[model samples]
Target: MISLANSAARRSLRTVSQVRTLSSGIDIDVDHYSSGWNIDDIGEFTAKTGKYQIKTFNKISEKGLARFNPEKFEIMGSDWDSTNANAILLRSHKLQESEIDVSVRAIARCGAGTNNVPVARCSELGIPVFNTPGANANAVKELVLCGMLLGSRRIVDGVNHMKDLGAQGLAKERVEKDKSMFGGQEIKGKTLAVIGLGHIGASTARDAAALGMDIVGYDPGLSIDSALKLPNEIDLTDSIASAVANADYISINIPYIKGENGTHGIIGKNVISSFKPNAVLLNFARGELVDSEAMKEFLDNGDGRYVSDFPDDLLWDHKNAVILPHLGASTEEAEDAAAAMAADTISDYLQTGTIVNSVNFPAVSLPARPDGAIRMSVINKNQPGVLASITDVFAKAKLNIVQQINQSRGDVAYNVLDIDPTANHEAISMKDLQKELTMTDGVLSSRVVFGTPGCGYARNIDGQYWV
Candidate 1:
């Protein structure tokens, strides 16, 4: 009457495969996608699925695939798009409704634009999330350089003028001639002020250093040691105004954001006016870092020219400006590179379950302990005496804590505790812990990870994690 033996075995294997952490640091999921996604393999993921995906652009709809099956596999690269946003919310909603074990990989996160994927939701679900930082450093660097050159040389404008006006000595020469009317200043000997020199800023600095331009980056967070290593000693400034003042061109590379925005505009009319009148502005970074209204006003006054990859909606009444539709890193090569980084990040995560660049999740990698530790990730409401009470419960169970990492993501607090299950009065598996933790008043949920590729967990401002 009961047909649950072999079917259940097959289902379980399909749902959750047994994974063992090996010496190579690859965490092989028993229920993995396929053998093609090997732990050590990087080029294959790109060579097979990604090349066409990135080149064709929107041909392979990972967004649709994610919507249909939220728990099937990790989404490694979701920077923007309406579909991506919906898919992100869909995944979060699914995770919040039940106890879900998940992994995520997001690269080029928090650089610019506020249309981020559902990062906050991952934290709430206790879903272990990972991201790759500085994966697009080269692309971003080249973008900055290109924007600066385009703005300074007025290449686009000069070309437009040539077409509009007839060329030659009689005609053709005239076209090539009088180009200096819009021809701009040479980049050499001009000073450049860079803001927020992480990976992008550092690369931009090296390129600018080769151009014989004096470099001064403004960031309260940067170290003097990092400044000194950039071929030439980049004069460092602590204040934003100090970086902008007197500089021929100001290139912003800050990862700043505001107003529920991780990467929105930071430069306003005030910041715009701070630079010298003839100074050009280049923003291939995050769009929100520059205020559209201020930019419109600045352009109206002919104070400067602005060149950016920001979308049209990001622009106000602007003139003397070139907007490239937020395509700073939209190159084919950049796509392949980003895809490889993202795929590898997800691949590593699906197996051994490590987080290299987690935006919402904690950065710690909870490796399996040699002493056979059972790790418990407990999510509970933010209030008093919850931790103590939970400790009492564990103490009553005669459990000994090995290593614990606790952090509060907004109102909810998460505790990742590694305990020796043998130290308990009796052995307690994840099922027992889950049931017990769920019944507790403040505990949203508790999970026991076998140290398979888990995100460690992700977080957001929403109250969904409490459910």
Candidate 2:
């Protein structure tokens, strides 16, 4: 029977084995094992078997679409109905729960947030949803800087005034006289409170620090690595109220989750009431994160400024508000990087069952499939004895496990098992093995992958409820 140790112990064993394999110089591709299989090899394998259909929404960058090997992937745009697609890639398109087809194994959003995708529903269906977190950090960071300037200075109003003057044919005469009317305070020496402290938040804080701004940050979920990367000048605060209490500017960089305890209206009356009277609030994250009614009251009651990329009906014509069309990640560089990351993420998950940057599933990865061995991926409910039941199936079939790894997140558990069929006492049918595995109690899905001599690699079996 296969040993079902804890996930941490299994990961440690896998690490030691990898180190030993590296020292032995066994001609194994360690990079491919750690990262993923080469696109060319996947293309070659799919060319002989069948291609994976990728249904794309919105205008995905051509640079990103190129990452998928044309021979192995069929890209379907808006013009085509791709209900049989193996995966979905999109940006800004609000994906409905009903729109997710049964054939889809994964969903990828080109940008950082998965709000546009039906993440909870996808999770229940055993579908992993991916998002590029730091892919557009630089773009959003630069835009946040612009938002700060717009909030502190009268740049937007000044430009509009100039257009009005030019239309009246008094541009040169009124330029000098009207300059003082658009005067505002400099951002230098100002205090900036950054909420969330994720990729975009950290980047914005770093750049703002370079501009001589005092940074105060608040994030309860901050990781050790992320905290270590923060600037030494930043003051860590315990709560949102304390962080923005005395700050000159406040930046909201958190995500928008919809639930009772979620961040849907994180910036409500209590949080807004604690803000400094003349403080400028910047939000490039999500509109739903802030309470619209509370924010409107805050703006109307004081001289504070509200600058955001997301537009709101109530705040659209507010004198203290500066709204811009959502352009946080609209740069060419950001779009290309996001698309490439999304494409590569989808390819790795679909071809090798290696998931990294997944928003809905736990991070799970395994080494390259050894020669003469087949790899099996199983998704099941996280419960006691689930692993035992899985291994019992292999034991009954007389299959020998070469290596295995398992990980869990919340209600879901994922297992990757490498079995050596040659070492089995009796021959087993691949189809029957998969069917039995899928029929196991609590099992959500199962997939089998093996390499062919002439072909690179192929998935011969898949058992999901939708399938």
Candidate 3:
């Protein structure tokens, strides 16, 4: 087995030398060669052998699709069978667990929320689900401002009334007399309670403060970075009740996770009952985060208004409810940003095993591979000795480790190892190494990426090559 491995390694090294000689003139300086090589070079080389198959669902922005180099990827439309896809990029398409095939390495949602995708199932399969958080934050924040104005000023009502009067040919006289009916308080001095101090919430709070609205924020899970972005004058509260108790306007910008302990139906009777009289409630977030029944009762009992980007059957015709067609992130700029972010994220992961902004996986990034090194990525259940066992495989094969990075999130762990063979050591068979790693207990999947020219990439799943 060792002799056969050495023969294959020698052949691979010869192919690498031949390709380099053909691409660049002989006697190239090592420093210049090292400086010039980049991820794009690997991508272009891989393109000649096999391009990564990317399946896109829904209408991804052209700007985002263009981020994928046509030389390195074959982008498929929604009609294509996703069974052989190396990755998926989507926007709001409801993806099922069954649709995730063995060939899939990652899933990138163009927008913030992964509610439309089966995240937990993908996590269990060792798949990192990427979300473009804050990519659409500005868009949603602008719409929240619109919702607040629409709720406070009764602009929709006035417009409808004006249309009716115009049809009756009495617009001039009636407009002056009835304009007072649409009169409402300005948001200048009103207090706003912002729930979930994430990207959108923080952006909303900063803008609202600039508009002279006092801000009260509630987010128990607020990170240091998010808190730093908040306005200094904004008040931070520990609980939802205290935040909305005295505020005239409340906005929910949290994610919707669907479990008893999750954010599903988070806004219930207790929170609604504590709302100040005539308060405006805005939910530009997921509809499921608020209890429809509780919101309906709140609307029925008071002069308060409900404004939402998502439409609900219960509040569809409510006199005090203003529902939009989920247009929070509908702007062209937001779409382009989100699609581009997703494309870049997936590309980075596929080419270099760098993960950022992943919802289910820990953020892990390693420096560029050393010259003539092979990169190996392993996904496994987060358990004791998994890392040790992985290193043991390399030790037995006598592969010199150049660099490594490992991170765990929840039940899964991701490992990336860079291996370079020394002059005295023989190269281990990459296929055998992948088989051994995947066969190891607790391992979910394993992939080997060759930095050596002409070798391309291979993964244990489906035993297919992805250049």
Off by over 4 Å in 3: 1-49, 451-467
lDDT of each: 0.54, 0.77, 0.79
List, in order, the clash count of every candidate structure: 29, 0, 0
Give the per-residue lDDT digits (tens) of candidate 1, residues 329-442.
665655555545554444443333345555654445656644455556666666798888767666766777887766664656667677655554333434334445556667
Q: Model 2 over residues 45-102: C-alpha lDDT tens digits?
A: 2221256678898999999999998867878885553344568899999997656654
Give me candidate 3's TM-score against the actual structure. Answer: 0.86
Model 2 ranges off by over 4 Å = 1-49, 451-467
Which has the better TM-score: candidate 1, or candidate 2?
2
Model 1's alpha-carbon lDDT is: 0.54
Candidate 1 off by > 4 Å: 1-114, 118-130, 162-173, 223-232, 260-265, 313-319, 343-355, 381-384, 391-393, 407-412, 423-429, 451-467
Model 3 clash number: 0
TM-score head-to-head 1 vs 3, winner: 3
> Candidate 3's residue-wise lDDT over 1-467, tens digit each?
01122322222211222122212222211100011011222223222225677888899999998999887888988676333467889898899765664457899999998888888888777889999999999999999999899989889999999999999998997988999999888999999999999999999999999999999999999999999999999999989999999999999999888767898888999899999879999999999888999999999999899999987999988989998999999999999999999999998998888999999999997799887676788888899998899889888777778899999999999999987655324424555565677767777777665433212333332332211
Which structure among the candidates has the greatest lDDT? 3
